[model samples]
Target: MASETDLGHALPASLSRPVLLSAVGRVMKSARAAAFTAEEQNSPLALRAYDLRHAAVSTWLAAGTPPPLVAKWAGHSVQVLLTVYAHAVDGQEDAARMRIERALADDDEAA
Candidate 1:
């Protein structure tokens, strides 16, 4: 992620809160409509809404948010949340292992 300083350097001087807010509102409205349509159609035959919620919870968990906070955002009880999404949390372990292996690989010059 870019730091605040990086953002300050990248953005134009005339950038305004109202312009950003309007853009964000449009994007959010489009995203919500898309989600609702997908959910209504059950497009993937497995309920996109459920998948979307699972993804949100998984991302929050991977980002180190506490389980209680994830539960609150997901509107699930902590027990149910943990039980249902335990496998999703395992993905983070896999990702960490991959990152470690990549970091430990021999340098091209050394090899």
Candidate 2:
């Protein structure tokens, strides 16, 4: 069951799946017509509403959100979330090195 906040009101599971999918298709078509560029309309951008969820999950992971917290939000186990989103969490080598350096510096200061 969807929460009230999910769609501004709870979407009863009793709603037909076909009806929901049809509605999403209609919305996608209209949004594409209004907002998409010529090339974007031809491409698979926002091809399905599920793509938005995928983007959100990827963005959260890349933004340094904790894997456990992101997994909870995405309704996946930590292991599954890491497996799926590991590719999206790239370009952090410099940040990782800085963190390691800081930890070592702190340790040396304490000694």
Candidate 3:
């Protein structure tokens, strides 16, 4: 992990504390107002930041990141990770079902 100092040089002299604070204040104000707006308030985006998180996790899972690592990154228990993301987990049972059925059909043909 890169420390703050390692990530980049120190802020220039022109980037003062008051300037940073003012910019942060404006962003917070805008975010607060957006949070309360009816469109944002009732929309799925506002209702479930978790869905976005889920999508990210699903992508990570599909990309072959190990379950334990993904769970740790997601701040979820392994059990909870499995329960919530079963559909996205690799080696799904439903995929096996079709293969099993085909094997049975092949056996019937042999019989």
Candidate 4:
């Protein structure tokens, strides 16, 4: 039998696709996601194995990974990456408002 371990990667290099899917299924069966609604348990939700890739991409983007690099890693065109992952980038409105307030306060102090 071939070696299954992959150095530096959580997924083994030789893990069969079916086994990988089964592993994800086992985790989902035990995770809180198992309690989710039928709609919430559908594809593109965390219940599916593919959702891990979505989470990974979204996480990298949320952690400030550059768009071009993310696109490259995701094997997508920059435009497609931006369009698809836009929903992953959230919660900037409050930060922007605070920055504007700070800038205005600094201007008032200068004046």
TM-score of each: 0.39, 0.71, 0.41, 0.47
lDDT of 1: 0.66
Candidate 2 residue pairs that clash: none
* Candidate 1, residue 59: lDDT: 79
User: Per-residue lDDT tens digits of candidate 3, residues 1-111?
Assistant: 222233255665555334464666566556646667766645555234445678999888766667888888888888898888877866755756777899999999999
Residue-level lDDT tens digits of model 4 in 15-87: 6345666876788766635577767656455756567788999988877677888888888898998899997
Write the candidate numbers in order of decreasing TM-score: 2, 4, 3, 1
**How well does candidate 1 match the true structure in TM-score terms?**
0.39
lDDT minimum window of 10 residues, candidate 2: 2-11
lDDT at residue 111 of model 4 (Cα atoms): 100
Clashes of each: 0, 0, 0, 0
Per lDDT, the best of the predicted structures is: 2
Residue-by-residue lDDT tens digits, candidate 1, 13-96:
455323555665566556666656656444453233456667778878877677888888788899998898786566577777
Shift of residue 14 alpha carbon in model 2, Å = 14
| Ordering by lDDT | 2, 4, 3, 1
Question: Cα RMSD (Å) per model?
Answer: 9.6, 4.9, 10.0, 7.1
Could you tell me which residue pairs clash in candidate 4? Answer: none
Model 1, residue 108: C-alpha shift (Å): 39
